[model samples]
Target: MRIESESAKNQWVTAAFECMLDGGLRNIRIEALARALGVTKGSFYHHFANRAELVRAAVERWELEGTDAIIALANREGAPAERLHRLLGVIAGSSAQQGRGELMLFLEASDEGVGDAVARVTGRRIAYVAQLLEEHGVPSGLAQRRAVMAVAEYHGARVIAAGTDSLPVDERVLDVGDAIRFLETTLLAP
Candidate 1:
């Protein structure tokens, strides 16, 4: 069963991504997503050749929105410190949605594409952080190390929050904010 319409295809991809975020890779079953979206399995087959292709599309959407778009937003004009501050602020604000990327990391052993996508996003994020650090006059090696540490702390917050969504959103955001502040004080201190 096949259908036509690029918008429909994108809809499937978006739904798939949302499903992934909601329940990880295992939640990306075609029938489940179709039922969730109120669409038929045929519609999914039309958009994606198979489950793996849909999963790839879903992960790609995650990369675009979660990684590429955020980096672009943080690249806007400002002093490096100001920009980094804004970046971290946005991250802390989005603590509720933080865990999907960390959850996706579990797929590294099972799905090569997911593993590669996660790796690329991680590297790109680390490089962006290191670039900002260098712009703030930190030496290259130190900047790289700090960027890695900073990213670790940020993603660690995500992983930790992933399991605690039952708590109030504010609490998770505050926890992430505290972690970010500690990272800043420890890494960005004079």
Candidate 2:
């Protein structure tokens, strides 16, 4: 595709992602996205062959924004502990809507491309965490184990945060903050 069309394609991908966040993966039909974008389905066809292709693109965009971008932001800090702090801080700040949207994406990941992208992003995130732990003087094997636990904790927090609307916002934030602090201390301890 031409550069202009590539930009248009990105618009479709972004719009689809927003729709998924507002609703779920089932909301990403070409007609729905086109209507949401104030474009035509013809425009979607120009970018994607089908809804599955658009879904794959949306998943890639999610991986980029949700994982790769966070890693880059965290890497700006010099010390490993500082990076972990920055990483957790950023992740914790994401809205509950985003956490729920991510859960929905994972739950709806039936397409081959979507599943592969999810797996790749998950592994990459764990590996990045493991590297950070090792940089903090954690043993290689132990760091890997801790990294898995850390990722699991982060996801678990997301799940809880997404489901805790009945609680007051401040209390929910405090609860998540407590969990993050505990994870940091555990991962950084000698």
Candidate 3:
């Protein structure tokens, strides 16, 4: 594989993402991607050593744009409780955009070569959420547990919403709020 300009590499990464969005990561083939971009497989090889490398880059891009960036925005100059709400809202909005079915697809695909990259990003995201919870007066250990629970709830809600098409964004917000309240009252309270 030969080196290419960063813009060309980014374009390949973007093409890979579109392929994933269309049919999960398995559908992302060098040949297909090249065909989609009106380029040759040689062009893809110039940018990525192999499919794994491309998958890793695509997953890294998703994590940076989707999870880490949203959490950062949520934490910007806000009260602890407000920040938590904003963070939950960000999850809710993303879930709504993804729809429940797509979330399952994403989670399944994350377990592939892309999974490690996703896990790394998710770990950082969880740590950030835990820190925010600690700042809001939760104990450090409990904050960490709550952050994990929050991620679980987000995934669970996506599943639930997918099963029931009628589940609204407001309902998802309420579910997240109730979960936060439970954590506060049951775990965080003295």
Best by lDDT: 2
- CA lDDT of each candidate? 0.74, 0.81, 0.69
Using alpha carbons, what is the TM-score of model 1?
0.85
Clashes of each: 0, 0, 1
lDDT of 3 at 124: 80
The ten-residue window of minimal lDDT in model 2 covers: 164-173
- Residue 48: error of model 2 in Å? 1.1
Candidate with more favorable, higher lDDT: 2 or 3: 2
User: Which whole-number lDDT from 0 to 100 does residue 99 have in model 1?
Assistant: 69
lDDT of 3 by residue, 1-190 (tens): 3334667888899877666655556766888777767777788878788898887777676777677788788878778777877776676555444543246446666466555665676688778778888987888998898879867666666666555556664563556567556644543453
Regions more than 4 Å wrong, model 3? 1-6, 95-111, 163-190
Q: How high is the lDDT of residue 158 in model 1?
A: 60
Estimate TM-scores for all models.
Answer: 0.85, 0.88, 0.74
Tens digits of per-residue lDDT for model 2 on 1-190? 1224648888888888887776568778777667667777788888788888888888888888999999999999689999998998898888778877887777777643477787888899899999999999999999999999998887776676666558544443567678679989999887
